[model samples]
Target: MTNSENLLEIRDLKVYFEVKGGILKRTVGHVKAVDGVNLSIKRGEILGLVGESGCGKTTVGRALLRLIPATEGTVYFNNQNIFKLKPSELKPLRSQMQLVFQDPYSSLDPRSRVGDIVGEGLRVHGVSNRGERHQRVLEALRMVGLQEHHMRRFPHEFSGGQRQRIGIARALVLNPSFIVCDEPVSALDVSIQSQVLNLLKDLQQTLDLTLLFIAHDMSVVEHLCNRVAVMYLGKIVEVADREELFRNPQHPYTQALMSAIPIADPKIKRQRIILQGDPPSPLNPPPGCRFHTRCQEVIDICSQVIPEQIDLGNQHFCACHRRQPVQEAATS
Candidate 1:
């Protein structure tokens, strides 16, 4: 897609964290948290990234907002190179880009009142004048279905769901064009998750906001994302529209993930493709296709060389050496 059509474009993004090992104070290796991830977010679209834990879904979201420095590659926000911006030049852009982190309980300041926590962004961005910031905070709270009276209470006073709502409110108070929801609903009860998801959908449409919704739950991604990308061992295995992915998953990893989603119908039983062994550690990622070791239909090519993302009609992309055109629709 063209630059004007995309809200956020990330090309070959990589984030590595330095790690020390052995007793000699020697820098052993780096954790390849996000290794060569490439994706784009269209204006006002929810792009979901899904994978197992430690798969770098959260790290990609954090790196997009510069919460962590990227070791290599480019992050373009509205076609502007965000990494090139100096700290001062990036300050204004910060207000336009926000994050609603997971674990709302620890994310909020326990000592501060909810109002102050939510309004902190407004204050930092020089929306001085306490009255105006307070007004914005209340409005933001109301937007997230919280009352103004609740603002005076501490974070510990609210339930897990309410805490997440406050976190959403904090992100909203800045009136950002884009928001990274880093597994925002993962910590809440299943019943409460629907409430938060519906609220996010409502708010997205109301505000015309773009979002990068990261989660390990395929069910949650199917419910909220316009498109979904499956990740495995710090790499994107496949990316396609929601219906396309559900109906015609390309990669083996994506298929495995889709099969695990519980089927509601009693008569329609699904066959789960259980992968063998644990995922390889990012500190020393396996060469070539990371999923090859566990993939049931692995070919010789999968082990020796990395797969190139290929388009299989409809712009669906997959990076599996054994990926082939399906004669039938996805069973599950």
Candidate 2:
């Protein structure tokens, strides 16, 4: 796709944390949290980043917002390289790109009133006038199906769903173009999860917002996202349109993940592909294809060489030796 079509682009994104050892606290190794991830989010579409826990899905989201420093890579927001910008230059852009955190309980300050929490961004970005900030906060809360009075109370007074709505309001109050929703509904009850998801869907449509929705649930991704990217051990294994990926998952990892999604109909039995072994530690990940150890479809090349992301028509891409063309695989 053209650069003009995308609101955000991440190229070769890698975030590694230093692992200290010994009394001197010297660097022993690195935890490759997000390694060589490349993806793009369109102007008004939700792209789901799905993987098991510790797969670096959250790191990618934080890196996009520059919440944590990246070891290497470039992130272009509106064609501007965010990593190249100075602190002063980046500060203003923060309002345009916001994050809705996973846990509402911890994300919100207990001591602060809802109004202050939601309007904190406005205050930081120079909405100095209290009346204006209050009005904006009220408008945001209303959009999330919350009343004006709810803002006067503290976070402790609200239910789990309301607190999440408040968190969403905090992100929305800034009138952001792009939002990194870091599993906004994961902590809530199943019923509450649907409510929060619906609210997000409605808000995205109403506000024309682009979202990088990070989640482990395939069913939720299928419901909310326009496109999906499957991440495995800090690398994206596959990317495709929502319908296409759900209908025909190419990578073995992607197929295994898709198999775990519970089908509602009891009559229609689906075979479950249970992945063997645990995920390799990020501190010392296995060579070549990270999923090769657990993947049932074993090939000699998979253990020896990294697979290139191969295009499979209709905007679908898979990074798997098995998915490569027979002639291309033979040549390699």
Candidate 3:
């Protein structure tokens, strides 16, 4: 509701990559990977970021952690802007924020043992004693449903699920207050995916951690996130509580996405919405409404004017010409 309630607040965030051409390596143009996004993660809540591939969801997560340099905008963690801090100054604060990478196979070092992999963070932050680090590592492993015996083995020795557990263990070892879960379940088997998601939920409650869970699957978001944000072409088209967004998607792009989610029952038939063409390249996005090209409900002004983020009741926000803003809620 206010800045005090938010653990992380993002304002007009933008990340653009320069397109180079010729042997001279001149800047031909820029790919607006993350054009302009406004989001906030409340303390101890899982905010799901869902979108199609190449929609800049991963880019947004990476930019928040400063893994990649941002083109513009600010990220405030605990009311402090992170990009302003120097590397040395930022290093200490980094321990409070961590990332669980998508691919557990490549994320872990194959050459290193699990103990060393998980304990490395503690060592970096100066745990100082071997005994304490070992205990902490074991506790973290146990928390993620892994045993101390497995700690002695290398990444190559473990299964996909086990490796993922190791990765979670590594993040948990830091005792971070905030984490970016970058599709942590996408690489696992369907059955194993639920296990990992449940493990994360358990860890979140146990640790009282704030999470930014990014994924392509709507069902997964519905299961784990408190609120879901739908991204399309570097912009958040809709954001609402999991039930509100899924049940009443306002944006055309979001509706199209929701329609595609397969239903388990054949007894009930649902209308399917098929978009006309692929999303336009980020380097040359549409002048006004990015979705106008593919939107079935497009109006005359849809292609000429940028739609404002109209706040529907109950903190539900959507950008579309057909949706009217609720005067009671804040509009941006």
Candidate 4:
């Protein structure tokens, strides 16, 4: 179990990419990939970051690790402002923070064996003893259910599931306190997806890892995360505990998303929400509520002004013009 206090605090983080055009290649506009997102993660709990493709979920995860620079805002890891730290100061903190990328196949090198691939971080961080690195690599691989002999083989030699395990092993090798799991199982088969998620949960429990699980799949998030935050057009639409969010989603975008999760039993009747049209382009998103264009229950105020995040006690919050707390809305 983890403490209730936040281990990672992000405030008003923005990552806008300048778009250049014309023969002059002059900066025309900006892609607001991440726009003023705020979040906090406890020391050992898994926080799910969910949103549609191109909604900047991955960007948020990348920014938290400083893999991508933030145009504005601050990231505080355990009360230390990471962005203000110099390169030399940042180096030691790297082992404490790591990223398990989305594509396992592309992330690993074809030229390197499993041992070298997993130990690359140690090598870069000056863990120069080959003997020590080898032992650490073996231990990490074993933690993810890969055998010692498997370390001699290449990444291409393993199945999709095995390769993901290797990727998890790569992150674990550093013994990092925080990991950004950027849709680690999205490319795998359904059967393999659960296995990888389970492995991650088990490892988190064993090692007390704090994870930011980024994915578009709500079912996976529901299964693994203690709390879930729904993102829409770079802003967090809603955030609450997993059970509360699923049972009483407060935002229109979140309600539509939760409704789309495929259920196993056909006998159970659940309302299905089909959103029309694509999400607004990040290059030029809609004003006010970014989701106002696609929301089914759109109000006049939604199109005119941005809604403030309203608190409903118990840390549950949402940005919506019409939605009230679950109890009040239900009783009304």
| CA RMSD, predictions in order | 3.7, 2.6, 1.9, 3.1
Error of 1 at 87 (Å): 0.4
TM-score of 1: 0.95
Off by over 4 Å in 4: 1-4, 325-332
The deviation in Å at residue 166 for candidate 3 is 0.8
Candidate 3 lDDT by residue in tens digits, 1-332: 33899999998999999999999999999999999999999999999999999899999999999999999999999988998999998998889999999999999998999999999999999898999999999999999999989889999998888889999999989889999999999999988988999999999998899999999988889899999999989999999988898888889898898788897789879899988889899999997788899999989999999887888988899989899988643555
- Please provide TM-scores, in order, for all candidate models, with all chains considered together: 0.95, 0.97, 0.96, 0.96
- Please give the ranking of all candidate structures by lDDT, highest first, separated by commas: 2, 3, 4, 1
Residue 118 error, candidate 2, Å: 0.4
Report lDDT (Cα) of residue 247, candidate 1.
93
Q: Write the per-residue lDDT of candidate 1 for residues 71-128, one digit (tens) a residue.
A: 9989889889999999998999999999998998889999999999999999899999
The predicted structure with the larger lDDT, 2 or 4, is 2
lDDT at 228, model 2: 99
Best-to-worst TM-score order: 2, 3, 4, 1
Off by over 4 Å in 1: 324-332
Clashes of 3: 0
Give every collision pair in model 3: none
> What is each predicted model's overall lDDT from 0 to 1?
0.90, 0.94, 0.92, 0.91
